[model samples]
Target: MSQPVMPAPIGKRGRAALGMDAQDLSTITERAGDGLRVLGLRFTNDRGCPAERFETLRARLGTSFEGIEIDSSPGNAAGIAPSAHAVLTVSLVDEPGHPTRVALDRVVAFLAEQLRH
Candidate 1:
């Protein structure tokens, strides 16, 4: 069985964009109130995704997944995972034409719009 891996601890830029400070990310999550969560992702081959790709996704997500818990494992999926209120996945592998960029843009637009409400 593959052990679940925690995403990197939220960085300073992410926290700032999320309007959070030194407090624990989990604690921030607890106070978020029924926000969207990107949990239960299973990576491919039981191996972790590349750190650079993960960080890219994290940076792209910005405050979209802020205060929300995210979890991952080893599995597979298509290039994009779109949720009702957010973009759930990005192309972990680099592809021609840069579909990841488009996905990230959708994520930012969707969640930023949600935040306005």
Candidate 2:
């Protein structure tokens, strides 16, 4: 007789698997206004690396600004893929145009630095 094979254990589902909850997601979504443009750097999806980075940046930036919103796409079927991408938009309460551009640049720079390590 042939022996039975056991299936592997599937990891946690969705963004929670990446260590994020509803509150976190809500906060980010609420913060993103009309002026901010979120820049997402590709990272590992198995561990929710992108979401983690976003949270980290949000914490570092403080709560004075409006907020950051994330729009993520579906994850790939492959194991621990990096296909998931998020668009973060920061709302502008002040003047538009130049001020918003400068803020966006700063946010991008911060994200880049975080991904460096």
Candidate 3:
């Protein structure tokens, strides 16, 4: 995968999925020798479509996810530009304890979110 300098993560800044919301993010720690190392990734605006928005989002998200690591540098510089959507790909340091999956369990148990409501 590319480094944090790959693209600039940008979009609507809110409690969206895969964002700062407790419902969207998760944390993972890997064992590196004698200490633990948390993982980090670069999130760009998908592209540089809205340069201004990307900058704002990158700045805001710079320190949003506390437990999780994020990298924002490589802003889109091709046909791909910033947009309001993203294809999710989450890698966890461990299994069965990730927050995203735990939330999903609740949804699955109810068959539908409306049932939980």
Candidate 4:
């Protein structure tokens, strides 16, 4: 909805969900393709929990993200903490027969809810 800029650091609650402390985890909103918006959440310290944590996240996600693609991988970002980091990429595409942009806020909230446990 707005112009893309540098990734913004997520809040305390989100950081806690990601098993991060001190080191920054940030997110950026950008266009992926035609009418596809992507939210890139990047973090350095998963405390080695990416595998189990994200697997659980993926399972709990289920059909909540039916039309969206959420994935994580080892990567790095400029101006982000710790240099080497993991990226949680959420790609949202417009659905046929849908009348509005995908509810990205809901997707993020659902992730937080599923990850908290």
TM-score per model over all chains: 0.27, 0.25, 0.20, 0.24
In candidate 1, position 60 carries an lDDT of 41
Which residue pairs collide in model 2, if any? Answer: 28-68, 31-67, 32-67, 32-68, 33-91, 36-90, 38-88
* Clashes (candidate 4): 0
Q: Judged by lDDT against the true structure, how good is candidate 2?
A: 0.36
Q: Which stretches of candidate 2 lie over 4 Å from their true place?
A: 1-12, 15-18, 34-37, 43-117
**CA shift of 53, model 1, Å:** 13
Taking the tens digit of each residue's C-alpha lDDT, what string does model 3 give over 1-117?
A: 112322343445322223234432222111222232222322344242233333433433443312211222345322222332221233222335443333334335534633544
Residue-by-residue lDDT tens digits, candidate 1, 5-52: 334325543322322343644554554435533322223222332233
lDDT of 4: 0.31
- List candidate 1 stretches off by more than 4 Å: 1-23, 34-98
Prediction 1 global C-alpha lDDT: 0.35
Model 3 collision count: 14
RMSD of each: 11.8, 15.8, 14.2, 14.7
lDDT of 2 by residue, 10-56 (tens): 33323223234668745654555433333433223323343444444
Clashing pairs in 4: none
lDDT winner between 1 and 4, please give it: 1
Which consecutive 10 residues in model 4 have the weakest lDDT in total? 25-34
